[model samples]
Target chain A: MAGHNESGKKKSSEAANDLQTFSAENLQNNMKVIYYSQTFLSIVGGVIAGILGFKGLAGFILYFLIMAISSVGLIAKAKFSVHSYFDCWNRIIFDGFFGGLMSFVLFWTFAYDIVHIF
Target chain B: MAEDLVLDTAIRDWVLIPLSVVMVLIGVLRYFVSKLMRSYQVPDAKIVKEGQVIVRARNLRSGANFIPPKAFRARRVYFSNEENGLLFVPKGQAQNAQAQMFSDPNMAMDMMKKNLSMIIPQTLTFAWVNFFFSGFVAAKIPFPLTQRFRSMLQNGIDLSTVDVSYVSSRSWYFLNLFGLRGLFSLILGEENAMDDTQRMMQMSGFGFDPTKSLSAEKDSLDIIQHEWALPKFEQRAEAVLRKLVS
Candidate 1:
């Protein structure tokens, strides 16, 4: 009975040690790592979109929209599992969707507004 | 052919563009009632997902590059039951997530409802975000070709074949396709809350942790004794970044 009790105490102490080790610092760092990777991807996305001829305001807007989608996507991943990261390829595709839709609508809306204004 | 091309351009300038204007106008008209046009409230987070596996599918269109067709159902497992009511488990991995919904009547049913009441959002995040994206995707596609392309690219996933091993299978899961995360409330219970949780969940999905819980005794140790941990973790983060982007 003495031996069993010693073993139990040893195990419980070890377990407590382990649990305490995972403090808020660790969780924050984990979150920070995710935050940085997303920033990296967003920077890369802007350069690529700009280089591809979606330049100036349109390019910037395109980048913003892509970054928005990417950030949102990454946010979703982080919020869901605290594990997943940005879907690089999915973000690219959705950027096209978001960019295309926004460009098309912005162009559409501007035309109508101009006609009425002028 | 040139005349038709001119007509097309002219119509886009006049008809299509202005029609899109009307769409937004109507979108605003129904904005208060419609989740599609409104910004949803991000729930005060409870249990963040630890890890998830997302399977994405795209169509092999005959012309032009592929488009996203479907993202196979996303399944996320919670790290602990302590997270149940406080953390919003996605609907994708576990449906409804009401412990009472479990087939086993022996499970604590009433307490489960109490938990659901205190925590889980009136609307799930992923479904809420999809409203705007889906409407945008829908309004833009005029051709049957693009429509078919969208459909073929979006929902063509076979979720059953995937291997999703996570802590407690009861955590929520989401099925995202073509900017639409499948509606859980309508399929499970709440119909109006879709827009609220949809986008929030979509944003959170990127940050999920794949590792299950790790209990390390040294976490509690004094910093002087554990100064070695930070660099080691930094190294691990690099490895994880490589694997994540790869």
Candidate 2:
């Protein structure tokens, strides 16, 4: 019974050490890094989709695939310790997913029309 | 898919390319214009101090568990004490801030400048697109859309038979207007004033009531039940070290 109580205390103590405090500057810098990378990746994806004559659902699926790859790259960049740099997993995985969508669509349509249609 | 329109390549050269190019140029131009027009108003010292006090109080509240109970109590009292606390703005002065904000001509001038920088180029761009590329079918999206999007995607072109994927020139301009936000952020940087949506949000959320925020912070600070976590952290650290040694 004492061993169980001791283990419970140890667990609570360990949990205390996991409390995180993030500075505004570091958080903002992390966000900027994500935004910049996502924007660049989305544009590239759009261009590739456009060049390959991707149409309809394929183009959007390609965008999401690119974003997924970007997320993986970000995870690798963070060395798989996303919690050290970000407050939540979503910050790295899904932060700029939709923000980059318009750029992807814009470039996709531009490239598609230029290459295939025109 | 309905029969695809074999659009003139001339429409591509004349309407589509120019409209996009013009929009990009105008976005860059607007960035620089807003940059030039942005008046660096030195924030009032009292406002700055109030902001700092609020931030410090918030930090103290959030980090209270890291500090000793006595220290947390002292800091909380320093901020939220009923008589002479930093956050205790008298009722008279709190009401005066609204009148003061309105009475300040420079604040109004700054607001006008911001509105002008945003409004002028936007109207000009819309007018230019409307006048030049009103009814022309510029380009087709690389994706299918539902019939619900026909009216939106085919604006200015009153064609009933055209595919919803086919974007009219003016509608394409609108697309570029909203879609170029990512490009602008890439080119101009994150906090640029080129985004119309952000500017509209800022315009609507114009008033920053400092007293209200300060009192709210004070109330929040008062309620923080600080249980010091450092003792637990130290025990955890010691246990980890012992495990490493074993």
TM-score winner among the candidates? 2
TM-scores for every candidate against the unseen true structure? 0.23, 0.91
Most accurate candidate by DockQ: 2
| lDDT tens per residue, model 2, B1-246 | 898888898888888888889989998898888778878888889889999998888788777888899988898888899999998777878877766766778877877887888789989999988987788788999888899998888999888888899999888988898888888887777667335566676566456578998899988887777788877877778887887899
Candidate 1 segments exceeding 4 Å error: A1-118, B1-14, B35-246
At residue B143, candidate 2 shows an lDDT of 86
Classify candidate 1 by CAPRI docking class. incorrect
What C-alpha lDDT does candidate 1 achieve relative to the native structure? Answer: 0.31
Best by lDDT: 2
lDDT of 2: 0.80
B174-198 in candidate 1: lDDT tens per residue?
Answer: 2111111111211222332344455
Off by over 4 Å in 2: A1-14, B193-207, B239-246
TM-scores of chain A in all candidate models? 0.40, 0.83
| Model 2 superposed RMSD (Cα) | 7.3
Every candidate's DockQ is 0.04, 0.47
